[model samples]
Target: MDGLIDRVETERKLRNVWHWLPDAVSEFPIETWAELNVTVADSNAPYRPVTRFESLLQKTTTVRYLRPEVALMEPCFDVLYRQVHDGVDVTLIDRPNCHTYFLSTYPERSSELLQQDNFTVLEHDELPPYGTGLLDERVTISCYEQESGTVQAVIDTDAPPVRGWAQSVYENYLSDARPIESRL
Candidate 1:
């Protein structure tokens, strides 16, 4: 801790990406936009302090990422994620207009691990107001349903032309990282 950047400075560095996106967007559920707030925690990295981020969807479609605690519990799904579940809630405001499919690959693990052995898509209202993943951490999706809320029609994880991304940035704030007397 003595030789590294402090927590305050780390938060500023982590927020670099959040502050870099567009300011507003339209086409949202309530005709309103959200402030982007997300948790910056790499597999082995320390948790960065929460900060609000914003990305414009259209002229009025903007979603603000916020809070890490909410993600671990009930995901707004507005952020990057992969979910695995046995089932999902069917009751919602609006439902998906089209049929969707979920694929399962056995190369990674055993089929017996899959509780339901199927992919489930929940209703739009059943999901959070923000973006979210159809599947949990497992290779399969949860219950299958209709949706059209703030959630995307379909998110392509492997798509190359997709928009929106979050990455970490490090900064140097220590007054003296190295002793001036030593130079190598």
Candidate 2:
């Protein structure tokens, strides 16, 4: 593959990407999701439950507040994970320093309809522009430059699941909020 992102590497990256997505999104099967150049993990923290991620925002020298997709990618991966079987093994290969289009599709086998594909845009130098078609109301990205290191990413607002984040975060906070009670 010309762009060639390692399967394992992508899986790991995919997992990291989920941090940007909304918590309302469903979880992907770890085994299956491990196929892509990116994958999702338990995080193990459990303390910081995911809610409205608001996308990924980082400021770096290479890029600026560029695209919203990049910001929402974390939650996006969560949704994607459910759609792909053995996706963890699937490498999201693409050319370096390029832009690509990611289309949403419905696989006959799976029921969920919100899945995205990563395409490398070597033909284009800049990252691909955001699309309005994804599950979100408006998906976008913004990038900013840093003097020395780090890239800044900004995300626009999107509709949360009808239930919203308040309930989930509250539940988590309450469940573990209390100090451990001991019965003598």
Best by lDDT: 2
Task: Give the TM-score (vs. native) of candidate 2.
Answer: 0.23
> What lDDT score goes with residue 65 in model 1?
19
lDDT of 2: 0.28
TM-score per prediction, in order, is 0.21, 0.23
Task: Name the lDDT value of residue 30 in candidate 1.
Answer: 19
Candidate 1 TM-score to native: 0.21
Residues 47-142 of candidate 2: C-alpha lDDT, one tens digit per residue: 121122222212111111123243334344544344243232111211122112233132332222223232111121232232111222322222
Q: Whole-model lDDT, candidate 1? A: 0.22
Best by TM-score: 2
- Span of 10 residues, lowest total lDDT, candidate 1: 166-175
Clash count, candidate 2: 54
